[model samples]
Target: MIVLLNLGFTITSTSQAADKIAIVDISSIFQQLPQRETVAKKLEDEFKKRATELQSMERDLKIKMQQLQLNGSNMEPDARISLEKSLIAQRDNLSTKAHAFEQDNRRRQTEERDKILNCIQEAVRIVATKKNYDIVINANAIAYANNAKDITNDVLKQVK
Candidate 1:
């Protein structure tokens, strides 16, 4: 009975040892995937539009402030003070709005990039399962690995 028990344990260990180990280069997959460029271009175009709008608003604000300054200097004290305050307030408000828009745009891009990475993760998991990988690692995590062991192409195919 002891010999049979030892034999069974050896067989189980051998089977487990036979399982495949693979490595994936996630950065490579992201770089190679078409979705990466599509998402990046969309983000760029959105930011470009916002920047153009901000530039136009800035030009308008400068013009309005210059006109206010010229007219305020010749006006009554209260009127001049009010105009000065309004110009300052408008400048501050626009600055704040532009800053907020930039922050929100960056956050949106980060969230989208993360979502794409999640999809890539899922694709890797599915392909690894189909290929019977017992252990999968990022290529960057290993110092020395053959190019053959890098499953970047496989992951990209699955993701795309």
Candidate 2:
């Protein structure tokens, strides 16, 4: 009975060892993807116009402020009050627009990042499936793994 039990244990261990496992560095894969740069450039281009407009508004505000400081004493009281109110309104408008711009840019960046991540995941799945991997793990989640089991390059190739 002891001999049979030992034989069964050996079989179980052997079968467990036979499982095909692979590790992938997802961050490395993401950084190496050529599409990453393309996406960044696209985002930059998309936001460039808004950024330029904001800068122009800022310059105009600064000039107005300087003019007020330089000529406030010479201006009629009513005219000075009116200029002050206009500056305040312009400043508030610029602030609101700038805040919205930042939020929109962040949202777009996150959207783009998620899309790239999805692409990477699909590539990993394809490589794992084609190579008959029973388990695939992210390198970041583990303490250490043999370099031989790393299938990052294969996934990168698939993604590219």
Candidate 3:
């Protein structure tokens, strides 16, 4: 019985050892990727001019509001009313432009993120297949894993 038990335990341990598992820190991989920075720069360059224009428009609106507050009481009623209407129109236009800018920025960010994620996924697949990893899991989803099982650096090298 003792011999049988030892044989059984040995087989179980050997089988478990053969069931390979790998862990990867995908967020870290994304951050470490050179493509991430290149994408960020591209997005920034695409939107910088519009962002600057929006800021200038915001500043101009604030100044107009301040001017109206200071001089409304001294101005003729018709002029005050016209100036108020102008400010309202300017504010509305600025609001619309700002909202559009935010939406566009979000869309661009999503696009860049998707592109990076696709690259990471491809890298993971290549490494997993090449290394014969039975399973590869995101490090964030796992409670604990041995460093020996980590393939993040391998994936990062592929990404770079």
Candidate 4:
């Protein structure tokens, strides 16, 4: 009987020492971050010139295509062939530039997103350490948690 009582006490103490867990809504925090908007604006500004140039090229190509359709039948065979080759080359150039622009934009967005996520992670770590939390879990991974255990706001404050 005494041995069983001692075992029960040990179990109780172990349960009492359970780790302090906290939850954070990473997506919510990410959305609310000012850095996200700033990065978006920066990327927009960086790519705006390229986007405008692509639009201009597209417009020019459309105009040339229209002109060819209207006048190709009346033009000399060699001149028509030359104009067709030129349009094809222009289209290929525009396609290449547009593809490169898209790749660059995506790369920059990924880089900025990684930086922002790292910032959020650091903030979560700081909040968790300062608040004596033993574990910090992403809110999305869990089905349910009490509001009191949510440290998302604290993390956001730390980040900002």
Candidate 5:
């Protein structure tokens, strides 16, 4: 019984000595960063022209489609066939452009997100080092963390 008591004491002391835990909400940090807004603005400005052009093309495609549908029954066979072919070609072009725009937008967003993530990591590292944190975990993975142990605000301040 004495040996078992000693073992329990040792385990408890070891755990106490090793408990230097902190939690941060990385998503909250990311969203709270001013850099996120800058990146979003840059992406919007970069893609604005292409997005506008795509919109214009879509409008044109819609108008042409309506015209075809409305006039198809009254038009001569050859004329109707020609107009249909033109509409098909325009639709294909619009589809291709729209797909390319979407891909480019996604890539740019991913790049910006990565850059912000790197910044957040650096901020966390700085805060952790300064506060002498032995282990910092994302709060998202924890069911509950004491507000005292949550360093998200500290990390955000450092990041900002």
Candidate 6:
């Protein structure tokens, strides 16, 4: 009984030293969350749709170029000039469209990243409050941590 009492005291002292400051892996939970997967799928579909549209435009441009090549020898000079002008315009339009898509995709990706980060931050705050932790550190900021000190699962559950 005396040994058991002493052991309990030692355990309490060790645990007290760990109090009020916790470490959480926000990236791990963000990667594992179902909402993140949903957001990723939506982004992926948007990217794919843009890629498909660009491919169709490219195919059309190639076809038009081939047609121009096959018929160029017999065409009047005005017709040839007009065709070349139109092809140049088409190429420029395609380039502009591609640039716009890239910019929009990047913007959307940034917004999504911010959204996930905000959610993680909110969860960390709530978990820290509920668990009586004075400060919650992000795992990325720490070099090494005890697994026993990981509060990621609790934060994940609270966030979800």
The candidate that wins on TM-score is 5
lDDT by residue for model 1 (1-160), tens: 9999999999998667545677889988878878888998888887887788888889988998888767867889998888788878888978997998889898988998899999999988998888888778888788875443456788898888
How much is 12 displaced in model 3, in angstroms? 2.2
- The TM-score values for the models, in the order shown, are 0.69, 0.85, 0.87, 0.87, 0.89, 0.74
lDDT of 4 by residue, 1-160 (tens): 9999999999987655444788899999999989899999999999999999999999999999999999999999999999999999999999999999999999999999999999999999999999898889999998876553889999999989
Instruction: Please tell me which model should have the higher TM-score, number 5 or number 6.
Output: 5
* Tens-digit per-residue lDDT, 1-160, candidate 2: 9999999999998666546888999999999989999999999999999999999999999999999999999999999999999999999999999999999999999999999999999999999999888789999999976543788999999989
With a 3 Å backbone cut-off (N, CA, C), the pairs that clash in candidate 5 are none
- Candidate 1 achieves a global lDDT of 0.83
lDDT of 5 by residue, 1-160 (tens): 9999999999998676446678889999898888888999999999999999999999998998898899999999999999999989999999999999999999999998998888889988898898888888998887875543788999999888
Q: What digit string (tens of lDDT, one per residue) describes model 3 on residues 1-160?
A: 9999999999998667656778889999988888888888999999999999999999999999999999989999999999999999999999999999999999999988998999999999999999998789999998875554888999999877
- Who is ahead in TM-score, 1 or 6? 6
Window of ten residues with lowest summed lDDT in model 2 = 13-22
User: How big is the positional error of residue 147 in model 5, measured in Å on the Cα after superposition?
Assistant: 6.7
What lDDT score belongs to each candidate, Candidate 1 first? 0.83, 0.93, 0.91, 0.92, 0.89, 0.88
Global Cα lDDT for candidate 3:
0.91
Better of 2 and 3 by lDDT: 2
Better of 3 and 6 by lDDT: 3
Off by over 4 Å in 5: 1-18, 146-148
What is the Å distance of residue 138 in model 6 from its true position?
A: 1.5
The local lDDT score (0 to 100) that residue 96 gets in candidate 3 is 97
Candidate 6 error regions (>4 Å): 1-18, 44-52, 69-77, 146-148
Model 6 scores worst on lDDT over the 10 consecutive residues at 142-151
Q: TM-score of model 2 relative to the true fold?
A: 0.85
Model 6 per-residue lDDT tens digits across residues 27-134 = 899888888888889999979988899999999999999999999999999999999999999999999999999999999988998998898889888888888887
What candidate 4 gets wrong by more than 4 Å, as runs, is 1-19, 146-148
Predict model 5's lDDT versus the native: 0.89
lDDT of 5 at 76: 100
Best by lDDT: 2
